[model samples]
Target: MKQSSAKQYAFSDAEYEELRRIIEQSVGIALASGKRDLVYGRVSRRVRALGLSSFAEYLARLRKGDQAELEELVNAMTTNVTQFFRESHHFDYLRETFLPEMVQRHQRDRVIRIWSAGCSSGEEPYSIAVVMAEFLDAHPGWRAEIWATDVDGAILRQAEEGVYPMESLKDVSQERLRRFFLRGKGVNEGKVRVGKSLREIVQFQRVNLIQPWRIRQSFDAVFCRNVIIYFDRAHKKQVVEGFADHLAPKGHLFLGHSESLHGLTDRYQLIGKTIYRRRD
Candidate 1:
């Protein structure tokens, strides 16, 4: 199939296969058969930016082990569609059921840890941070830490920056809007910065879920929402098992609305909508 316009470089089937291989091998995400146009649109820009004339040349450079180009390829292929409070029900559950129980369980230590796996552009972790901050504010002695991670370094930088357009905060309540964000001013008008307190509670890091995870700390809750859909069954199983391994006993795992652990593993029991609890 002709992948791009005549003015732009053509993407051959062989070149697509090579790009697909690199993406799957490096990130455990499988591009479906119909994603040729999408891949071409994202990757062709990279080819042009590097002054390459064709997808064949891009594939050749990749085959010769260009690590930087490989990084760019992964960044280009990875999808990051997220919003603040994307699934409001999950946050409601966290606020009403989970946080109270967690506070009681960790009363002595006064610490709670949550992981936002595949956190894109800081929204998920920031949402978690908002909830945690509300709880901690009410209970003065408690502390909460949120670790947000993703494979794409570029998007992680955006997350670390914690800046977003005003429209992105629409779902966020007026109350939260006033409490958690500072309205941008001057040349920064129409943007919002997450408050210092909320930002302080969340940390962003580059983590490829398919690779070996070096984090040793167990978490009370893990939000890997909407992430595993890109992976095939085997890789999905691997990532879920890894989440189970790192969760504290009876910890909760939240999947995306379209995702599930049915036939994947028995380490967790379904507790709520797209939510699972680690079996004791």
Candidate 2:
């Protein structure tokens, strides 16, 4: 069904379909037809921002290769819904089982690398940093690094700043809140900044998962939770295969609580809740 013709500049089904295709090709997120309203709500601002009259006019500009506008469109379309320690079980498994194994496997190198794909607003990577820091604090004598990437450059900048509202720490314990974050003051009251220790271990990058980027490092664990669920099956396979290529042999891949690889591929084995290890 098409959007109502009653309203001027109604986001028609054809325009929405075109937008969906472009977004999927660009970032692999298969926006649903149900997302028409969402797409319009977010993108109409873009049209108005360009002083354009209609959605058609804005999309025509996109067709003309306005690289900057394309980027902004993607950013606006991308959702950055996240919170600290969101799926707590994953962190539990990481702190208990995965980190120990990583440290043991890399005894000779004394280094561990983890990737936080789709990390938004710094929460996921910062949470991982807390786990890594506590492990290093107890075990000592090792370097652990995390590469956090997202498709949204605007959000990536916010992640790099390492700042968050104090309420985002509800799940964060007092010990961690004190150890890994610095409290804000006066003008900045009600917020906190990720402390130096966690920041030292996390490096931020803007990357489109389906597209190529020059990331030379391999990782022992990849936290791509909740990301691939937006992609179509083929793109999910492509993205997961790409992760497999970059992961160390037998390394772990963590998906969202609701995500799975059952029919996607045979590259991994389900070892725990939402956890898969690359097959040997």
Candidate 3:
């Protein structure tokens, strides 16, 4: 069912400025002028639901710190647009380069720890799991622990279920399709669900990367793709520095293709397409 077009709610100049400040303060994303359409398009539902006619009243309600109001605002601002294997280069690099090097160095443990830091609805992590599962199957003796996390609780819940429409798998390979997913039967035609083996391998949790991440054990790979784009320079630097602190020696950092660590930090060396390695 399509949601009706939201009521036209106008914002005073002061309210608009405050809204911009609130979003930037909370999530570190900068909103410039001409985003008024985006602002109204996103927040109009809030206005309608609250039966409020003005942005000022909505802002006033949010100021009271109503938990639901806060969550709605955050959800409205966050970009949850993601899909399975959206960036194939990162996966290819992982399979061809990163895994080979790790396999050679850590022959004894034969363990792989991968973190999908900004995992949205499980696609990134599930993609990682499928890759690792295939690699391990070919290698004869290896185990992997894949941790998938996001700040949004609602999306995390959807991810835990591991069910998706057929459209979501358009870019996925047939071999991976056969191995990691089950074709829905009965009332589930035209749908696919991740097989238990693949689903069980990924541990999903809610995490805000802006806060101090306390996972003391370092990761062999961290897929924080597309996440840093929303963060301002200082926040990006802080996140990257923190990532360097926790990343294992020689561990890989894979970011969004458009994002860059250039002038941001000297902690990692550029290796492949958008892939960075921890400095030894």
* Residue-level lDDT tens digits of model 2 in 7-89: 54678778999999999999999998788778888898898888889988998999999989989998998889999999999
Candidate 3 on 186-269: residue-level lDDT in tens? Answer: 899999999999987899988777776768788898899999998889989988888888778899899998999999999999
Task: Indicate the residue-level lDDT of 156 in model 1.
Answer: 96
What is the clash tally of candidate 2?
0
Cα RMSD, each candidate: 1.4, 1.3, 3.9
| Per-model CA lDDT versus the true structure | 0.92, 0.91, 0.85
lDDT of 3 at 183: 94
Q: Which tens-of-lDDT digit does each residue in 1-280 have in candidate 1? A: 5455564777777788878888999999999878988888999899999998888888989989998999898999889999999989999999999999998888678899999999989999999999889877889888899999998999999998899999999999999999999999999999999999899999899999999999889999999999999998999999999999999988999999999999999999998999999998
For model 1, the run of ten residues with the poorest summed lDDT: 1-10
Q: Which candidate should be chosen as best, given lDDT against the real structure?
A: 1
**Which should have the higher lDDT, number 1 or number 2?**
1
Model 1, global lDDT: 0.92
> lDDT of model 2 at residue 135?
84
Poorest stretch of ten by lDDT in candidate 3:
1-10
Candidates ranked, most accurate by lDDT first: 1, 2, 3
